[model samples]
Structures are given as C-alpha cells and as structure tokens.
Target: MIEQTLLKCEEMIQRGSSSFYKAFAGLPSPRREAVHVIYAFCRMIDDSVDEPEESPYSIFELRSHFQNLDHAEGHFIWPALRWLFENFPQSSKDQFMLQMQGQVRDLSFTHYETMDQLESYCYLVAGTVGEMLLPVLRDDSNEEAQSAGIALGMGMQIVNIIRDVGEDLTRGRRYLPLEVMEKHGYTQQELERNVVNDRFIAVLQELKGAALDWFKEGLDNVHTYPPESGMAVELAAAFYAGILDDVAASGYDVFRRRAYVSDEAKLLMFRRTAARYPSPFGGKGAAAVH
Candidate 1:
C-alpha cells in the first residue's frame, strides 16, 4: 500500500518538478521513493505561492486550507506527514518539516532586514527539508546525519535564491536581505530594476561563497550515512551544484534571466550517477542497499 502511495507521490513530483525528477533518477529505488514523496508535497506548497496565475486568495486563506486539512494544526503537511506518521515512526526532525511548511504557507516572501534573518528563513523553508530527508535516506536517526542534512538544505536554498533574482523581483519578492544590499550599496530600488552593477555582482559573490561552504558541510556530513543513503544525498547535491555552474556560466546574470542546466548537462549528471553507486556509508557497488 505504501509503495503504491509512494509511486503516486513520484508521479506527482514528475509532473511538478521535471528538473528534480531527472536528477533523482540516479538514486537507488529505496531512497528515491521517500525523496520523491517529500518533494511532491513541497512542490505543491511552493506552487501555491509562486504560481503566477494562482487564485487571488490571501496567503492566510491558502494556509487555512492546509490547516483545515490537518484539523487546523499541521494540515498543510498532512499529505506527507500522515503517511510518515502512520506508516513510519515520526522522527523528531521530520516533525519540524510539518510545522515549517505551515509557516511558509502563512508568510509570503518575507523581507529580511539582515543576513541572519534570511539565513533563518532559508533554514526553515529549505534546510528543514534536507534534515527531514536524512533519516529516510540514511535509514538511521543520528545527530551527525541530521545536522548535515540541514546544512545541505541550506546550501540548496542559497543557490535557489541566487538563481531567482529576476523572477522573484517580478513577483514582488526579494530573498536578498536588506542589510547585505545596504552594505554593498544597493537599494531596494536597485533590486526592483534588476541592476547588474559591480556592487550587485560582489553581493552575489558573497552569497555564493556562503552557499559553497554549506554544500561542503553537507557533503562531509553525509559521509556518515550508510553508502546507500549517501547515494541519495549525492544525487541531490550533484543536481543542485549544477545550478551553480549555470549561474557562473551566465556571468551571474540572474538579474536578466533565470539560470538552468541544459538537457545535455542533466543527462550527463544522470550518467555519472549510473556509473557510481556505493553504499551510503562505504561499500563498492552499482547501487546502494537500504
């Protein structure tokens, strides 16, 4: 029954996130199902917020729908949470995702006054997703894996923020914190115009540097998971990293357009995954075992 539901989730994600479906293709089946389920839920929530033609309903109304689904508590996450809770033990970290997703649904495009606030928001929305997936992928509940998972999510979120500069502006959203902009001498006005000045480039570089550190941290931390679990993390990390490559290749022109890895590049990433699949922790093989 769970397998069927998981397949349903995968189908949902396939329709929602073509980029992710392609990247996750290299993941071993065991780890792939859970990641797909989680992503399906997230993609739905994100669409509710980011979709251009979404209903004119207020953020509160949208949040209320999920809240009602969960009986006014954690309904937004019920689609995924109910499955994990009824079928699998609820990891403490997984619980955080339910609450965090609700939080995101409640708030639309929070304007950050400082770097710290932006970091915290990113951790809540994206980092927590990584943390939640760690237990499912690693097949264990441990501090090291949880911490690393959180960092990995944070890194991915940073990359996403950098890539969405132009898109977010069009949507009346800005992920770049105000203090960082001021420190670099860019006003909110500059952001709206999507200016591509040297100061803007410097600010972006600074954010990119921070994201790189989180990616490094995530890579190191996932090493503790069994080799099979590590394979899942590796696949996701590799896909997100490709975004960075696209950003750099575009000369950080996120102000003019969004960045994306080409179909050819995505196929290459899939090939790399097919060529190597070690144990999540350590082992030699073409695929990781749970």
Candidate 2:
C-alpha cells in the first residue's frame, strides 16, 4: 500500500513537471520518493488556486488535510504525506503551510505595482519550495544554505514570470512590476498589446539580469549539497536559464511562443554535468568539491 501511494506521487511529478523529475531522479530511494511527494503536493496546491475547477481539493481543504495529515484520508497525497512525515520527521511543516498561504495570494492579486510586492510573491510561491527541499537534498539546512536555496527559487520564479507573460495576461495577471516596466519605458499598455519592441526587450533584460544575479547567489552554496544533488540543482538552474537564451533566439516573442531547451540540448547538458560531478561524486570547484 505504501509502495502504491509513493508510486502515485511519482506519477504526479512525472506528469506535471518533467524537468523537475529529471533533475532529481538520480536521488536514491526514499529521498527520491520524498521529492516526488513534495512536488505533487505543491503542484496540487498551485493547481487548486490556478485551476480551481479542475483540482481535486480546494486550497482550504488541502491545508486542512495537510495540517491534520496523520489522520487525513481520501487521497494518495494524504497517504503520501503521512509516509513523508513518518520517514522524514525533520521536515518543516511550516514551509509546506506557507506554500499554501502563497497560493492564496493568486486568488486576490491580479497585478503587481512594485518590486517589493513581486519579491514577496515570488518568495511565497517559489522560495518556500527551496526551503522545503533543503533538508531532503542536503546534509545541512543551515541559515546560509537555506537562504541560498530561496535565492535560487526566486531566480527561477523570475524566469517563470518572463516566460509566462503572455499566458499570464490571458488570466488578467501581470507579475512584472510596474516600476521596472516604467523604468524601461515599457508601459502596461504596451505589455497588454504584446508589443515586442526595444523597451520591452529592455524590461526583459532587466528581469533576466536580476534572475542571473539570484542564480549566482543560489549556486553560491551548491557545494554544500550532496554531490549528485548539487549537480541536479545546477542542471535545473541551467535549464531554466536556457529559457532566456531561447527567448532571445526567438527574437523575444514570449507573447506567442513558449521557449524551451531541446532534448538534445538537455542531453549535452547532462553530459557536461556528469563530467563535472563524476560517478563516485567529488570533482572540484563550487559544485563538486574535494
């Protein structure tokens, strides 16, 4: 029964986010299964708000069940959560609950006016993910390591905002800060019109630069992770960062097309990563130390 429950979680992750699944698949045993569970719950929480009609549980229901997980019933996720908590007692329930709180923001926030607002939203939605994964992926969840993890999540969230601008507009949501847009001379009207002009490019570049900066801060503590895990984190960051490159290659048409790194490119990236981390771990540098 436990095996079946974990398998359901695995399927949820494999179906929902292949990139995430691929990056962490190398983990051994319960750790790998744990990642699957975390992703599945987070995905469900996100879908509950983002696609309420289709989600299995309302956001409120999810929180209730998660808060009372030991006796919670009625879904593979509940059993999976029970197993996760049983196996990893150190896991932070607070981080998981905070994630639910973050999803609730989508219910009311339709537009953002300041970088502070955007950052707070990003932290709630994505930074918490890093904190959630820290204990599962690394030996130490110290303040510095956890902070770096949040930075990585924030960077990835910025990339998501840049890539999903068009899709977001369809939902009447604009994550880009009004101040940044104004500074770049790109008006909200221009964004709504899908005008891919110089100012638009500037706005994207500004966000892209910010994303890269956070990525650097995020990776600053990579060596603190287990070798294979460090490699996986690095790879996920590389793939996300690649989206910006593809956007540039597409002449910045984020409005009409979603940019992606090809499977072939992923293979090449995997090879480079494998070379760095090696089979028995320990390569060098900030990624695979000693």
Candidate 3:
C-alpha cells in the first residue's frame, strides 16, 4: 500500500515540477522513493494554502493528523509521512513543523516589511525543505551541507517570488520586502498597477543579485554530498537559477509575463552537469536517471 502511494506521489511531482522530478530521478532506489514521499507531503500542504477553495481548516487537520500519527492510519499522505519521520526523525520533525508554520503565515495575507522578515518566511517555507532533504542526500549530518541546502532552497524561493510578482499581486500577497522596494523608489501602488518601470526593474535587479549570491553559496558546497546526490543538487540548483536567467533575458519584465526554463534547457543542463563531472551517472537521457 505504501509503495502504491509513493508511486502516486512520484506522479504528482513529475506533473507539478518536472525539474524536481528530474533531480530526484538521480537518487538511488528507496531514497528516491523517500524523497517522493517528502515532496508529496509538502505539495499537499502548499496546495492547502495556495488553492482557491482550500482553507486554514486543512492546515489544522494536517497538524492534528501529524500529532496523532497512529490515528492517521488510513490517510494517504500521513502514512508515507509517518514512514519518513520514523526513518529520518531528526531531519523530518522540526523541518516539517517549520514548513507548517510558513503555510500558516500565508493565511494572513501580509506584506513583509523588511528583508529579514522575508528571509524568515523563505527559511520556513523553502529552506526547511533543504534541511529535510539533506539527510536523504548524504550520510554525514554536517552543518556545512545543511547550510548549503538551506541557501539553495532560499535562492530558489527568491527566484519564484521574482517571477511571480504580478501573479502574487492578484492573489493579494506580496513576497518582496517593502523596505527594499521603497529604497528603489518602487511603490506598492505602482506594483499593483503592474507598472514595469525603471524603479521596479531596479528592485528586481537587487533581489536577483541576492538570489544569485545564495545560489553561488549553495553550489560551492554541492560537492559535499555523495557523487550522485551532489550531481542532483547541482542540476536542481542550475535549473532553478536558469529561471532567473530567463527573467533577465526577458529584460526583468516579470509583470509582463512569467519566466520559465524549458524542458529542452533542463535536459541540456543535466547533460552539461553529467559531462562536467564524468561520473557513471553521466551521458544518460532524462529517463535513464529514473
């Protein structure tokens, strides 16, 4: 039963995030299945907050279900998550709680006033995923690897915020720090009006610069993981950072259209990473990674 559930989880990831699915494919057996379970659980929680009809009640239910794991026997996500927590107790518990905290924060429809506040939100929402995945990606529980993972997740989340500025406005949320916007002479009113002017572009450039620095920090420690895992992390980081590149190529007009990295670009990135490393994991097609 758990096996079937995990298979469905894999399908969910493949459909929702091809980049992550591709990265996970590089992992060996049971570990890959484990990661799928993690992704599925996170995806479920994220949807609870982001989807139009979903409500805070779903998050409350999740909290209740997590607290009473044994009573959650029949639940699809709980069983898998229970297995994950049991297997990776240290990494799973706190990180999962932090993720839930971030989701709860999303329900209030607030704007971040400062960069620190935004970073805190990012750490809870995305950095925690990195910490949770660290145990699965490597045997050693070192601080450097965990830090790098968090940085990687932060970089990706920042890029997501940059790309989704217009979409987020429609949802009555703004992830960008207002302090930074004010510093760049960009106003909330202008943003709401979908103004893509010099000031807005400047704000984006500053945000992108910070994101790129985080990516560099993450990539620097990518080699800390075992070869295959390191490659996977590297590929994932590159693919996400590629979106920022696409945004730049589009002249940072995030309000005009959403930025995305194509599948062909992803495949090319995988091949490039494989070629650069020259490992047994290299030269295989996307399907081969699975």
Tens digits of per-residue lDDT for model 1, 109-133: 5577878877887777788887667
Which is the winner by TM-score between candidate 1 and candidate 3? Answer: 3
Q: List lDDT for all candidates, in order.
A: 0.68, 0.86, 0.83
Best by TM-score: 2
RMSD of each: 4.5, 3.5, 1.9
TM-score rank, highest first? 2, 3, 1
TM-score of 2: 0.94
lDDT assessment of candidate 2: 0.86
Q: Tell me how far the alpha carbon of residue 1 in candidate 3 is from the true structure, in angstroms, after superposition.
A: 1.9
Least accurate stretch of 10 residues (summed lDDT) in model 2? 281-290
Q: After TM-score superposition, what is the CA distance of residue 134 in candidate 3 from its true location, in Å?
A: 0.4
Q: What TM-score does each of the candidates earn?
A: 0.80, 0.94, 0.94
lDDT of 3 at 77: 77
RMSD of 2: 3.5
lDDT of 2 at 145: 91
